[model samples]
Target: MKYDWILFDADETLFHFDAFKGIQLMFSRKGVDFTQADYNQYQEVNKPLWVAYQNGKIDAHELKHSRFLQWAEKLGTTTMELNSAFLNAMADICTLLPGARDLIDSLSERAKLGIITNGFEELQDVRLEKTGLKKFFEQVIISEQVGVAKPDKKIFDYALGKMNYPCKSRVLMVGDTLQSDIVGGINFGIETCWLNRHNAEKEEGLEPTYIVSSLVELKKILIP
Candidate 1:
């Protein structure tokens, strides 16, 4: 392997992040019928909050509490309670992406593995534990805990510190998002592989070191 360290983004990269399903499950537990219309409404509020979070316009607590405020008011509960329930529901339904296990298992023997995600700390820990992937990671750096999100060099600096300041050339960042994972790693003077699973059109001035459509493809790129 060309790299001594392989870093991954959690949600939608190594694991499936079906927020709609999670929201539905959370509401169902509260005896509310969460419909597609309801999900659309939730996303209307939730999507921008995530963008704001990644852009450093808001913190994790604000993003979580703000998104569920309307629901909290309707359900006669606190936003904290609703947010916690949503994360719990998401953890319960977590599953690895196709080839994620094989890729991780194979890479574990070669390079150290770590996760640097913008995901909340509560769900990330539980999801990894449930999927039996916790033992494979040398470090799991959550943005919420670090107080800085991706696309910011501070978080990458924090990750490298946790990694004992490995040579930047010998670390590879693999992630599904261009703005955060790809650009962040690039800015930090490391190689990056963009996991373009859906073949999304590439934006100008945002080139990743490599691109692969799936984890299987990624495995070939790294291992072969």
Candidate 2:
């Protein structure tokens, strides 16, 4: 099918978080002696804070500082030192997923490419620029910048509005998360492609128009 525009998710879809996790683990193990349980607890606390930030219940600075503070409290570590370590670890590990840059370079020639991510605008922009993927995107709509998150439909619609494209069949949304990318795209009446990198089972109620195991598969399905 011919598509006029394509929206991508930033984290797992383009920027692999697993690499970041590894760096975090390495740093935490060496610096603070964090256990697996501590890391898991940190994620559990951090994710809900992000969700709250997405919903506009909390600001970005608060979310970041608070998550780090809470994690340090649970681990009985120095909050100031741990916070600095977290920032440094994250900064040191910002990298793109495999085939990300090449896929974006190929797709940009065919359709308008952009990113719709639920993340801090500053952080996402820095990561994109660092990974050398920023130039390919016509626009990058971050939830922190837009004050709304995915699956809300408004965020997707806002991205379409920025692209000046009609909300029609010519648009496609590609991402890893079913709750965000697939559900939001379907809600906005656009084709949805689920990037199931791990080959996880699909939920019963949600569906995607296409499923790709890798970004390279996008070229097979989307016509130039």
Candidate 3:
């Protein structure tokens, strides 16, 4: 293996993070029927909050609470209550992406594995454990605990420190987001692999060391 360790983004890259389904499940427990319109409304509020979060303009708590504030007030619950329920719902539905387990297992033999996610603390651990994929990683770094989100170098610095500061070139960052995962890894002076499964438009000026449509393809690159 060329790299000492491989770090991954949790949601979308390793697992299917169905936020809309999670919200629907959460509301079902509350005896409310969450509809397509409801999901659209939720995204209208939630998307920009995430952008603010990635830009470091807001902290995780603010991002978590603010997105659910409207629903919290409408349901007579606290933002914390709504947000926690949402995360629990997400955990209940979490599933690994196709080839995630195979890819992780194969790479684990050649490189130490880790996760660096901008996802909240509530869902990260539970999902990993429930999916039976928790044993593969040495570190699971959540931005909420680190006080810095991805695309910022501090979180990567913290991750490298946890890995005892291995050579940057020997660390591979694999994630789906162009800005946080690709740009952040580039800025941090490490190699990156973009898991562009949907063939999404490449963002201007951001380049990844490798791009693959699926983990199966990535497996070929790393383990072939």
Query: Per-residue lDDT of 108-204 in model 3, one digit per residue for the tens?
Result: 8889999999999988889888988899999999999999999999999999999999999899999999989999999999999999999999987
Q: Which ten residues in a row have the lowest lDDT in candidate 1?
A: 120-129
Better of 1 and 3 by lDDT: 1
Q: Candidate 3 at residue 31, lDDT?
A: 100
Q: How many residue pairs clash (N, CA or C atoms closer than 3 angstroms) in each of the candidate models, in the order given?
A: 0, 0, 0
TM-score for all models, in order of appearance = 0.99, 0.83, 0.98
Please report, as a residue range, the 10-residue window in candidate 2 with the lowest summed lDDT: 18-27
Lowest lDDT 10-residue stretch of candidate 3? 124-133
lDDT of 3: 0.94
Task: For model 1, state the Cα shift of residue 151 in Å.
Answer: 0.9
Q: Tens digits of per-residue lDDT for model 2 on 24-67? A: 66456656566567678778877898777755688666776777
Alpha-carbon runs more than 4 Å astray in model 2: 19-30, 51-62, 72-88
Clashes of 3: 0
Model 2, global lDDT = 0.77
Query: By descending TM-score, how would the candidates be arranged?
Result: 1, 3, 2
